[model samples]
Target: MNYEGSGHGLARFLAKARQGQGFTVGALGGSVSIGHGLKRGMRYEQSAYSELNMHRIVFDYLDKLFPAKNGRQIGGDNTKRGANRFVNGAVPAIGSDYFAMCFGHHIPEDVDLVLVDMAINDGFSEKGAESYETLLRHLLALPNRPAVINLQVFALMFQTIATGGDIHQGISSYYDVPTVSLRNLLLPIILQNSSYGISYFDHPPGTTELDREGLGTRHISAKGHGLIGRLTNAFIDMRIRDLVTGLYGAELESRLVPETPREQIRALQRFNTYEAIPAIPPKCLSAHSRSPTLIPSTNKGWFKYLIADQPGSIVSFDFVTAGGLVQLSVYRSHNAGLGTAACWVDDMKDKRVIIEARWDDLVSIGYTVTIANDLEDGDHVLTCELLEETKDPQKKHEFRIIAVIR
Candidate 1:
């Protein structure tokens, strides 16, 4: 497999990591990174579902390349150990726009390398480009200056050599970071082998089958994921060697300037940063019929949150700073009872912004929704209320409050 994009930053980091000077690695992406559809062992607390995802494969490779000195165990079990640490920060079905709000707080400050594998989840669009660039700049600007590699894992149906692959290339070009496209690397091999009997572009082998809904959709099988992991490891090895031996220094240096210039980078850095806003708990507010109740979040690690399923349930908070942009952390689910909520800021009673509190799948997960932007600097009040109920009587429409940021 061939390595795509610049390798200067990645090479510098890998050289140190390869020599037993361990470093922490982090990943940010969606379901593919979460090992969706893979088999899991009966053990309830495995780091991943039977270790079938890309991040797991990369971690294994790192362990072998740089063996741990003390043989520290990972995930509180002796099943895995390595000098370097790994953080699988990927959340299923999330996009780059929600990265900072959802998983930013959890990422380690001393991260040395980050793998961004969100091409399929992000789709191919201009908004995807902006969000992708925003995520890249945020990682680069970190105090440690961690190296980032865009690992684009895709299926033949959702992405091809031309569509999602091209979009990722454009974004990577702007950041001067290394990128590895599974579409470009794996598709050619699959296409040449007639034994696989795959004639149509969309009907790639081991990618489509009858899922729970009896519909033919694209999902990489376990074997396919392994192939991707192997290809990525090979690409990393090649790039590291090239960079360390000074074979590609000039080409790598040329990428630092980006194709569009520095203005684009500056704009993204400014737009992505925000101050964390304090959320006022319901108990602090005056007792009212619509006040939401504080309860433990069904989505673990979120601590206690305010949740209400009844229509007209209200959660309000105040902000006393110069507000340019505000984000509301919410919970979304595909359950039939989930409904929608309306948000109002300050005296904008007539301008109620409706937010859908439903997802396409059964899993309940945290999401960040931007409620307001470009607000005047001063005191401001925000109110969120359940506006409607789902049609299903068994399921109740609910909204969860996680955090507020501006």
Candidate 2:
């Protein structure tokens, strides 16, 4: 398999770490990195029904190459128990932008190598690019200068490959980060190999079958995830071998250093330098009898939010800043009661932007949307007016203002 971008940084890091210099590996992404279809244990345990995801496989390989002095279990359980050096910080259905809000707290400071896999969830949004760059910049600026690898895994379809692959690749190139695209390896084989007796572009007939399991549509099956892990490990192995052999010449160290584009660096700097004003606690927001109510979030990972059942109800808040980019952290849910909201920034009199807040999942997940990116740096107000009640009669509008990232 051809490693699409460059893995110079990753190669150098692995080469050094392989010789008893143990390193901590961290992963942040969507379901693929989370081992969605695999069995879950108390720790990072893999049962008979479960297989190692890419993160786990990488950890397993690392442990093999440089065993820990006091190693515990070697599966998903190890990560949970902190017995393993790997940290899986992936949240299912999350995109690049969503990661920005909780990133400071979720990603550990001591992470030596970080693998990001969010190709499918990020889709093809311009904001995805911006947030992706932001994530990369944050990682690159870490004290340890961790090697960040962008992993792009695809479903059994061309469209999924094209969209997710392009966006991740673009970011990877801009930052000189190493990237691995599973589609790049599987596409040609899928097109040419008829002997596999499988539908290379679609899920197999039964969900229980191995081929179907291997061609997991949106969420990859256990076998599919295992294959990705194997391929990724192989790619890393090859790159490490090349580096050891001095195939990259004298410029290897320089090549490994990330050379982020100047414009992107400035954008990220602006994003980072901006002062953030916390949202008013949900308890203070007034709600009508028919409006969505403020409730304690069941998911402790997210900030508290408000939910509205009545259309036309409004959730308003104000903050002072020298206005620039103002981000709204809202809880978007696909379950019935959730509906779209028309966002008005600054003076209530002036209309800035309107966003349709909806999701496909029943559980409420926190999402960050840039409400006002170009506000004149100063005091500004934001209001999310529920436009229409959700189609689900039983469910009401769900909204939350978790944090305001300027």
- The lDDT per prediction is 0.58, 0.58
Tens-place lDDT digits, model 2, residues 1-406 = 4244566567656655655545677788876677765543413223221335777777788778766555534323224333336767776566677665445444566677888887776666676777677677767656667778777777543243455457767667767777777777665775576334243223445533324233345555556567677877887778777877877665564454444423344333445544542321111111111132323322222232355556666655565545466676665666535566677675644655555456654334456766776678676666666666454455555554544555
Give the worst 10-residue stretch by lDDT in candidate 1.
280-289
Per-candidate Cα RMSD to the true structure, in Å, reads: 8.1, 8.0
Per-residue lDDT over 1-406 for candidate 1, one digit per residue giving the tens place of the 0 to 100 score: 2246656566656656766756677777766666663443322224343466677787678778766664533432122333577766666556665664334543565677888876765556666666666677667766567778777776544323243445767667666777776666556666686334132222334744322222122445566567677877887788767866777564453344223222343333345434432322111111111222222212221223466777777766775445456666566766635677787777786776777777664434455567778688787777777766564445567666655655
Model 1 RMSD in angstroms: 8.1
Query: Any runs in candidate 2 off by more than 4 Å, and if so which?
Result: 1-6, 19-21, 39-51, 69-84, 156-161, 189-205, 208-216, 247-323, 331-337, 342-353, 359-367, 374-396, 400-403
> Measured by TM-score, how close is model 1 to the native structure?
0.71
Residue-level error in angstroms, candidate 1, position 336:
4.7
TM-score of each: 0.71, 0.69
Cα lDDT for residue 147, candidate 2: 78
